[model samples]
Target: MRCPYCGSLDTQVKDSRPTEDSSAIRRRRVCPDCGGRFTTFERVQLRELTVVKRSGRRTPFDRDKLARSIEVALRKRPVEPERVERLINGVVRQLESQGEGEITSEEIGSLVMEALKALDDVAYVRFASVYRNFTEAREFSALLDEISGDGREAAVDEAGGERD
Candidate 1:
């Protein structure tokens, strides 16, 4: 490390400590020539992620955008904000675990749908309607059917009886 005051290459690390998040290391350095001290941080750099849009355009991965979409879909629902945040983190983790530089928006949407489905049906439908771009009423009916069918199966299994 170089001394900022005297521009001398005579700096030594005085202290080293891990950051609060444990994602990085914080180092304190002192310039022997000028007796000046400064701090530096070191962190593991991950490869940048690109998000491929539905239109085939590519952009940098954005966590806020993903979170905002989830928030909107879960609005007026029983879902918690922390749940949405965790879902976003889960989607991001899934993409990162692939170790790929670019991922399709469809993959991201699918992860979001899966996460939401495990949370609330209404929220899942809201997200699926926007993510899948549902146009016809039949599409919504199909979604309703899927949701209700799952409920029916669960109820029947619990009852251990045949449907009327």
Candidate 2:
């Protein structure tokens, strides 16, 4: 690993262990040049996956990007970071095991929504608002109703009623 302090390539691993969820290996490393210590978590990638954008653009899958998006949703919520990591790990595993190299953006969004809903309601709505492009407060109401088992169909009809 390159030293973040001095940009040196010589770094020694002092310790290694599996994370709590066993999804990644936690490594403590020290840079010989700058004597800087840092911890890195490494994960095994089953395969290189591609994300198919809605506009027909194909891009390499990014795990950090996925985590950032989820973190934004879980921001200020009571959800634990470990749970978030597990959620992200689960989504990545599911995508890799799908037997296909390319996955639609919609599929990823759906998986995130389902996972967030199970983890926390506020986080789910926060993610849904952006993933689903909620434009008004009523859209949120409809989603909240659906989540709360309060007649989603009726709520949607009322919220989505004539906006003119």
Candidate 3:
């Protein structure tokens, strides 16, 4: 690596360690010419994925855009930041695992909906409303009904018996 301070080509790695999250490697380097030291981080980049819009336009997949959408839906919710990070990472992993060079916008929206649904019902509904383009009150009510029904079934299953 080139030395940042002295603009020299000779630099030696003094130390290397994994970052706190273990998602990247941090390297401490020193320039032999100027005796200057600096740090650099290295991260693995998966293959670039393309996003195919509804209008048939293809664009490079943007992780920040995906995270912003999820954050907007999760705003004011009781969820933790770590959970949000994990959700984003999970979605990205799932997309990458598909091994497709391109994925439709609809597919991404569906994945977000599924992740939000498991994270928070209110957030899920919020995202679904925008994602599904819900215009009628009945659409929301129907979704809420479905969510409530699922909750009831889960409760019943956990209780190990039907309601008396």
Q: Rank the candidates by lDDT, best first.
A: 2, 3, 1
Tens digit per residue, CA lDDT, model 3, 23-56? 6689999999999999987756577899999889
Candidate 2 regions exceeding 4 Å error are 152-164
What's the TM-score of every candidate structure? 0.63, 0.92, 0.70
So what's the TM-score on candidate 2? 0.92
**Candidate 2 residue-wise lDDT at 87:** 98
Clashes of each: 0, 0, 0
Model 2 residue 42 CA deviation in Å: 1.4
The window of 10 residues in a row where model 2 has the poorest summed lDDT is: 155-164
Looking at model 3, residue 7 earns an lDDT score of 93
lDDT of 2: 0.89
Clashing pairs in 1: none
Best by lDDT: 2
